[model samples]
Target chain A: MNSLEFYVDHLFRKYKASIQIQDLRFEVLGNLEAKVADLTANGVGYDEAVRMAKENLPSIDHLIDGNRTIYINQFRLEYVQITLLYMVIGWIVAMPLQFIRTGFIHWLFLISSAIIGVVYLVLLANRKNINMQKIKAFNLNAVFDLRKQVWLVWFIFIGMSIFITTALQFGSNIWFFRPVDISGPYQFAMIAIKYLIPFASIIVPVIFHIAPKLIMKYEVGENDGYKE
Target chain B: MGDNSISRDIIRGHIDAIILRVLCEGDNYGYEIIKAIAKNSDGKYELKEPSLYTSLKRLETQKLISSYWGDESQGGRRKYYKVTSLGEEAYEKSLADWKIAKDLIDKLIERQD
Candidate 1:
């Protein structure tokens, strides 16, 4: 058999997936070449090294290719969580402010907070296309859609936290002018949630995004599950 | 591509045995071992990269075979693997088992005819 035919047959046995034959060829030949390079640098003869590489591989090409499937799944989970977080906060703000006929500042707070959640959702969804192979695209789209809805939830929660803070500030500012008041405990918690939730979620995404990259960097390439 | 039930089952049966036996000869890398199998099988048997790597990982995890970085530089840096004493023992047992299996299957096929 010609070299290409031999290699193609070898690849077909291991990786039966429907990708192009050239892709298969590259994977096999590339890995073989790497081995040849390594053995040559170690003072091994070219023929000896080639022969060595030819004898070693035992039909596991799919491990490397299958990784993309795994990574897409990881992305799916992250966006889903982001979606749920947003949904909860949206309902909170729409509840109280729906009827409150307040001044321009109150409405501004409500409107901007609601819009901010949707904005966060848009940014995430717009960042990537769901054109992943093997991963269901509709499920991926649902993740983004859920994200949009959840952001509304988060925005509402954010608005409540802010509204409470505003109320506290307004209450405290006026308290000094009043006859009396005791509001130390209320001050403590509002400031805490006011500063904490966004930071927590921020760090959460950082950890989420950073993990796979770290794994990739340190990952000595081998059979990583998506070969065939 | 669709249903690989039979192929996967056969490969799984031979995977650990193949890896251990191959490593018994000398240290090797992923692609090279696969190539060797193809050459030995005369193009009749071949392994996919995914299945091979998974078997390699299983062996490595079991401490039967060990892999190290090779200094070879043809296209990419390769991880070289060698069979441990444990792997050698495992290989021998598996070899015996395979012989018995081949005989049984051969007899069954002959009987069918």
Candidate 2:
């Protein structure tokens, strides 16, 4: 019976519980236990009975159909919203520094920020259509297993950023830290890129590491509300 | 077993109807309903647990049935499902539709010779 519960739980591990989902879970476990019991009573061994009971059920994909689509759409929305937020925040943070040091804000960065903001608003407005596309494209299993890989990528990103930045800061005559001889737009471009690199290196990794888990936590909370 | 796949595909199309017909006999919990279907088919057909719940959910959403948790003195608590008046009407309609489909298919596919 415990094994029966384990099997059903494993199949649904990716899904968050709602009232309907919870009821369905218990119903599935109860039916599976009954099937196993009947099979065992008819002289089938315990392990075989469990296996047969599992085999009699349909695939998890077939079972999840509609409910799973809701979660997938939510996940995609969270991913896009978080990415846009990070981009906007990155540009805003860089703006003040550019103004304070260079006596003017960089137009390129400001324009990029505006573009990102527009994109974010468009996404918010057309979320339903985007979600439909996502339902067809996103792989739920990969998203469920993403937290660990996200962390690993974050670590590698941080390590590489630190190594490159340290080498640039200390290495003899590295253009990154050296005083620029040019006096026009080329100089501004160089300084902007140099400043942007370290900021991006620090910020992008942190966002990558944190965003998925944040979305997952929000999904769990949303589902928790539906629990009876 | 080889022919079971093709038959199962045909059965899959009417899983909801089949489940509703079982509940038409009496209110039943998940396991009992599954067993009844299997028993009636002489073990030739067995609905998978997930598929059963999935159909049950669709039926519930359509207001064809309602469910309640059963208090079992032993083992785990069970969720029982009862057919709604709406469900009984849907079941009858589904049965009538199936008969028409079955007869049409039989006539169209049968050998004249």
Candidate 3:
């Protein structure tokens, strides 16, 4: 309603609405109003009273740090879970495709998927400890900078994928060039599709896992910000 | 009346205790608490709102004080804080501690002759 009230509300704009936060906000706003009322009653002008009240308010950093730990932890857990879910989904989609083309399930594909699944479970189990480490290592500036470079990370990943696919296709003398007796464009295309399915299954998960960490690494430097 | 940084830092450390002492007189809301501090100090000290809120939260977390919404008839409902029994004990402990510290500091800093 007044300048003090507006400023207090603005400060907490980013926080999600919850009972605890709402209670804190209500308490803070009431205090600011009372301070302004008292100051103005004592002959201080409304503008000066508002300014003094605002100046007395504590920094948002301390307030957020004290109150938002649980919310931040839940967000981090969800981020990890979603990333792992994408990996699992990639494997699930690839497994049947591989079987349909090759006439048999790929053992390597199955094993790697199981490994990634296990890693996912282990990460989930140790999430609390990992979250504590993350909080300790967090740098606000670095995180913002890392977020800005996300597009570059994806571009590099796509480039690497193209290079790997091209090398495997030609270097083995398989897809683009094959033995004269067995060579045919149809067979070459089918083989390339089969290999590409497996390659994608692996690469997609690897990229999903590495992209965020890569950004974190670039921002905070290797072995310094996050240990695992 | 002088706003020296060192004195302010010392006062900040005892903000929770100072707040508890204010509550001992009567239950007060946020603004009233600040006014009480200013009144008690004869306008010599004014606790900033941020530090005051932080200390209030810390005290609430420690269970030394409790807060509740007051049913104001107009404007907005105000939140009032009351010192718990635990807070009273803490206040006494902090007061004694301050006295000892004050006496010790005076002795240490007093000019010779």
Candidate 4:
């Protein structure tokens, strides 16, 4: 590789690689080669030509659109970690209430939430070694993967909520050691809706409205390091 | 290079138009486009590589220009840009606008002795 290519590669080494970035790198390298060749033909020494080519490209930040950059900061990851930790704590605290009034499935669901949160925290911690200094261009694949993960989490939570609420209402027929009259699926549906009403009404809305603001609190400005 | 900075700033806003004007002659690649601009301006203005790449990207995104990979006969595969029909229209419009602006600025700045 020429000095120009090596220089460009070194500058781009910190970014997460994607097809778009690869194409851009190739384009830049080819142009720099052409410029260096032109300069050398004009009586500039090979080394000086390469240096001039490098000097001409002061910054590559403009090569990618501002909106597409992924500025990986400590704050975004930490915010997610804290949010997951709070979820685990909340589920564990709610576990005792499950024993008094709810069935075994409800208790299992609560435990599962805590376990999932712990697993997520472990996975997140493992990813902490990434360099937080460099900003990178958007990776479409990563965005799609994250979307799939978010949907999977939502599906799992909602499915568990439905199952636990249904089990709480119909899984047993004993109430305070007395024989309780059992209704059909209609009554079970009513009970499930009753229990889920609080979750759907309150928790979901809170997550939608408040979580974004909370996460935004942790965002380090793009200009953080460059400030005098 | 004292006057170079002010001229560069004045020219920066119309970089897209300038590029489109170059591509209007024929399909061209990055270094060639820079050379063309420098030649046109008698070496007074040299478009920085960063600015040129950014403007080229923006123009491509706007569908004002399209690019293709040239055959690698010249050691490296050059990405050549062509002015689109929309780009030609944009260039014409910008040229007319610049004409009016230039005339007005000259009249305003000219000394009345």
Top candidate when judged by lDDT against the true structure: 4
In candidate 4, position A33 carries an lDDT of 92
In candidate 4, list every pair of residues with a backbone clash: none
DockQ, per model, reads 0.33, 0.21, 0.22, 0.33
lDDT of 3 by residue, A1-86 (tens): 76766897887887777788788788888777787888899999999988887876634544543222122444455555555565
Give the DockQ of candidate 4.
0.33
lDDT of 1 by residue, B1-113 (tens): 22466655666578778767777878988777876886776665667655676688679878999867666544445667899989888888888988898899889878663
Error of 1 at A201 (Å): 8.4
Q: Tell me, per candidate, how large a share of the native contacts it keeps.
A: 0.39, 0.54, 0.59, 0.63
TM-score winner: 4
Model 1 segments beyond 4 Å from truth?
A: A1-30, A34-68, A71-94, A97-228, B1-5, B69-78, B89-113
The best-first sequence of candidates by DockQ reads 1, 4, 3, 2
The better-scoring model by TM-score among 1 and 3 is 3
Report how far off residue B83 is in candidate 2 (Å). 0.5
For each candidate in the order shown, give its overall lDDT on alpha carbons. 0.57, 0.68, 0.68, 0.69
User: Across residues A107-160, which tens digit of lDDT does each residue of candidate 4 receive?
Assistant: 554655677677666657766676665554443444445556665666677778
lDDT of 1 by residue, A1-228 (tens): 534336546645544455443444555565767657768889999888867766565443334333322344445445444544444454453344334332333344456556655665664675565442223112223334555665666667667766776576566666667643336976565455444434223323333433344334333333333333
- Give the alpha carbon lDDT tens digit for every residue of B12-108 in model 2: 8888999999999999988888788988888778776656766887899899999888887876668899999999999999999999999999999
lDDT of 1 at A170: 61
lDDT tens readout by residue for model 2, A107-144:
44466567767766776788767644232222345554
TM, every model: 0.43, 0.52, 0.54, 0.62
DockQ of 1: 0.33
